[model samples]
Target: MAAENKKKEKTATCYQDCCAEVFNFYLGHSGEHEAILQCVHSVLPEEFKRIGAGKSSLDVLGVGSGGGQVDVQMLTLFQSTFPGVQITSDVVEGSIKLSNNFKALVGKTANLKNVPFQWHIMPSEDYVKQVKATEHVKKFDFIHMIQMIYYVDDLASTIEFYHGLLKENGRLMIIVETANGGWDTLWKTHSKDLCTHTITEYRSSAEIKACLDKMGLKYDEHPVPNTFDITNCFNPKDKFGCDLIDYLTAKEDFYASVTSEVKEAILDLLKNKCSSQKDGKIMFDSTLSCILVHA
Candidate 1:
C-alpha cells in the first residue's frame, strides 16, 4: 500500500508557479522565514551551531530557493555570525523563471557581501543523479530542504541523497510541513477550495529512522511546532487574504489536474477555515519534523 501510495503521489501534479507566486509574496513581507529559521535552528543542538567552531568560509546549499526570499534571512544570519568572510552559497532550483526572479531578489538585497550565492538551476531528479555518482558527497556545510520533499517521488531516496551531499560531520537541515498534522488537516479539509495538490505520502520519525538504518545512516529527529500567523496580511474586503488574494481564489482551470468541483471545495474550505479563526486569522501550523543526520 505504501509503494502504491507513493506512486500515486509521484503522479500528482502541483500548481507550482501559482504556489510559488503566492508563497513568495508572503515570504517577502511577513518575515516568516526569519521566524522559521529561529525555530528550525532551535531543533538542532550545538552540533548544528556554527559558533565557536573554527570554520571560516562556510558552504551552504539551499534547495527549492523560490525567488530566493528565504536567502535574505539565511544570508543575514551568516553575515552577522561570521563577519568579513564570504560564505559560498549555492541555490538549487529548477525553474529558469524562478531563477531569474531569484537573481533580481539578490540584486535588490545587494547580493549579500559576506555570502555569495550561485544558482544551480537543475531539477531535483538530476540532483539525485549527482548524489548517486558520489559527485555531491560532503559538498555543503549546511544543506537545507524546506517544504520541498512533497514534490519529490521518493522520500527515503531523496533524504538519502541529500544526506549523501553532506560531508563528514555536515548537517542536513530540513524544515518540512508535517503533512499529517494540523496544517495538513486544514489543507485537506479545504481540498475542494484552496489546495492545488496534495499527497498523503509522508515519513514519520520512526519511518525515516528505519530508512536511515537501511542505508547505514544515523539520524536524530526533533519535532518542532512551526506556526504562521498572517493576520496582518489580510484585509476584510479582500477575496482571499491580502495582496495575493487571487491566488487563494484562483480559478479551477488554473490547476487543470483537479476537478472543478474539487477546486471549488478547496476554496470554500479556505473561506470557512479563515472565518472560524479569531480576527480572521490565516494560520498554518506547519509542525516541523526536523531531521538531523550525522553525515
Candidate 2:
C-alpha cells in the first residue's frame, strides 16, 4: 500500500525571502561557522607559518565567501599569523545579494582595514574562465573553498583548476559536510526534486578524498564536530518548525508540495534517526569535514 503512493517532486527556491532567516537559523543551531574557523586556525601548516613570517605579502582566494563573516575570521587568523603583511584576497561569490552583504561587512570591519580585496561576482567556473582568458596567470598562496563545491558545475575540474592556481608550497582548503551525516541521508533520498540545478551534487570529504586518491594528490583531513537544535521541528504548534524542515531539505516550503503521508514519514524519520532528544531539546548532528591539499 505504501509503495503505491507516489512521491512528489521536490521544489526548488532561491530562498530570496528566507535566505537570511534560514542562514541565521542554521548558524544558531549548527555551530558551523565557529568550527570552520577553528579548523582553519589549527590546520595551518608549519612551513606556511615559517614562510609567512618573512614574507611581506600574501595572495589569497576565497570561493563562496558569503557575507564575509567566516572570511573575516579566516582573514583575522591570517593577519595574526603573519602580522605586518599585506594580503590581497580575490573573493568569488555568485549572488549579488550575498556579495553586497560581504562588501558591507568589509566596509565596517575594522580588522579588514589592511586587507585589500577584489570581488568577483560570479560562479567559480566563470571566475576560472575569466582568469584563464587573461594573458597572464595569477597564482595564489592559499585558496579556500568552504562548503561551496556543491554549487559548482564541474566538481573535479573546478577543484583541479583551483589546485593549478596554487603557487609553490601553497595550500588549498576544502570543507564539506560528512557523507555519514544527516545531510547526506536527506540529499540521497530526496535530492531528485529538492536539489537545485545550480547544485550538482552533495559531496562530502569521503568522496573528495577518493577523487584526490585517484589523482595521486596528497592531503590531510580534519573533523569538525557540530550540533544544532531542531526540537522546534517536532512541535506541531511551532511556527518555525516548517521553516526548519525546509532548511533541512533545502526547499522553499517543503510541506507545501509534499503529500501528507510523505511529510509525516519524513518528519518521523527526522525525529527518530536524524536527531536525538536531550533534556527536552531535539539536537541534530551537523558535522563538517575539512580537507587540506598542498602543492
- lDDT, each prediction: 0.60, 0.75
lDDT of 2 by residue, 8-66 (tens): 11111122234755776767666888887777677764535843655678888998787
Error of 1 at 221 (Å): 4.6
Candidate 1 — number of clashing residue pairs? 9
Worst 10-residue lDDT window, candidate 1: 245-254
* Model 1 per-residue lDDT tens digits across residues 154-185: 77778877876676568876666554654455
RMSD of each: 6.2, 5.7
Q: Which ranges of candidate 2 are over 4 A from the true structure?
A: 1-21, 45-54, 196-200
Evaluated at residue 129, the lDDT of candidate 2 is 88
Error of model 1, residue 196, in angstroms? 8.9
Error of 1 at 33 (Å): 2.7
State model 2's lDDT. Answer: 0.75
Candidate 2 residue 293 Cα shift, in angstroms, is: 1.1
Please report the candidate that would top lDDT against the real structure.
2
